[model samples]
Target: MTGHFLSFEGIDGSGKSTQARMLADHLRQAGRDVVLTREPGGSAGAEEIRRLVLEGDPDKWSAETEILLFTAARRDHLEKTVWPALEDGKVVICDRFADSTRLYQGITRGDLRGVVDRLHDQMIACEPDLTFVIDMDPAMGLARAKGRQGTEERFEDFGLGLQERMREGFLNLAHEFADRCVVVDGARAIDAVAADVARITMDRLSPDAASA
Candidate 1:
């Protein structure tokens, strides 16, 4: 049996996590088996890595070092969480995936995208079957993120400038991977955005659509 792998990507506080949960709940209500997860920590080992990367100062690790750390976590996550679910024909919804690394540690610091790509190809050569890129204004995203007052504010502490660049990067990725990436407008009400996501995902999950 095979399963679908879906990922949500966007600048921080774009509401991707909420949407991920909503989608999981929707799928479950529809009687579909679903596994919801996230990164830079999904599995046990990766969760430990998550704190190291997400709780420190903004300068805790260079972008290059971050790339390695993220890749390591991703490999562990796939082995311990994602792969097993997919093997069981369970729909796997991940809050963030390699694309986040491709941006956060790739171009945000400098032009280390090549390094990120190479490392990913070598150690974590997997991609979600479909990706939801929640598009939002950088200023709004940062403000919402700060309002959360979470300890994992290392990335948020980078300021609005980082979010702006990451926004552009995510948009560019939608074009680059148009086949599997769908950009969802995230400025609307929660129900509205969730409705759109459910409609789109249901269509993708349809038997005819899958067979096509």
Candidate 2:
């Protein structure tokens, strides 16, 4: 049996990582083999790139340079982690993926959507079988992100306005990729959001659906 690829995406503090873990745990309990990973640090090489891109001065790299670095990390992640796990029939649950690049870089850099898309098509052309975009208000999300302590404060440091733009970008992506993307209300309680994620994931991974 082939495995399913699912990714969780959202603003900085929309609880996407927690939900991704929850779904992976839930599926594992249900007897499915699950590979819970994240980008742009899923593989060894990617992790190094992650530090360069994430733990620096916000302006450490130019917009174009940042995009190139992200794409390189993604390529390493796919080659070393994601593709191998999928080929081995393990359900792959990623905390974030290429869509993060699309939204973050697309919003921060001017007129870079075309570059992002072209890079994706040429280098990283795969999408998750299902994507859960946890929707929430930028204000609330920023507040939550501010509570976190990490050197990865580069993207989180974008503040509320950028977060708002990112929210819109993600929502647009959900609509654009309606077949594989689902927007979940992330403002609710953690358990509530987890329940929704699990249910939707099971629906897609069910035997009948799988054989469809």
Once fitted onto the true fold, the runs of candidate 2 whose alpha carbons sit more than 4 angstroms away are 208-212
Can you write out model 1's per-residue Cα lDDT over 152-200, one digit (the tens) per residue? 9999999999999999999999999998899999999999999999888
Whole-model lDDT values for every prediction: 0.91, 0.88
| Overall local distance difference test of candidate 2 | 0.88
Q: How would you encode candidate 2's per-residue C-alpha lDDT over 1-212 as one tens digit per residue?
A: 36679999999999999999998888777777889999889999999999999886777887788889999999999999999988888889999998999888866556798898899999999999999999989999988987888788888776788899999999999999999999999999999999998888867765632321
Q: What's each prediction's clash count?
A: 0, 0
Predicted model with the maximum lDDT: 1
Candidate 1 lowest-lDDT run of ten:
203-212
True lDDT of residue 168, candidate 1:
99
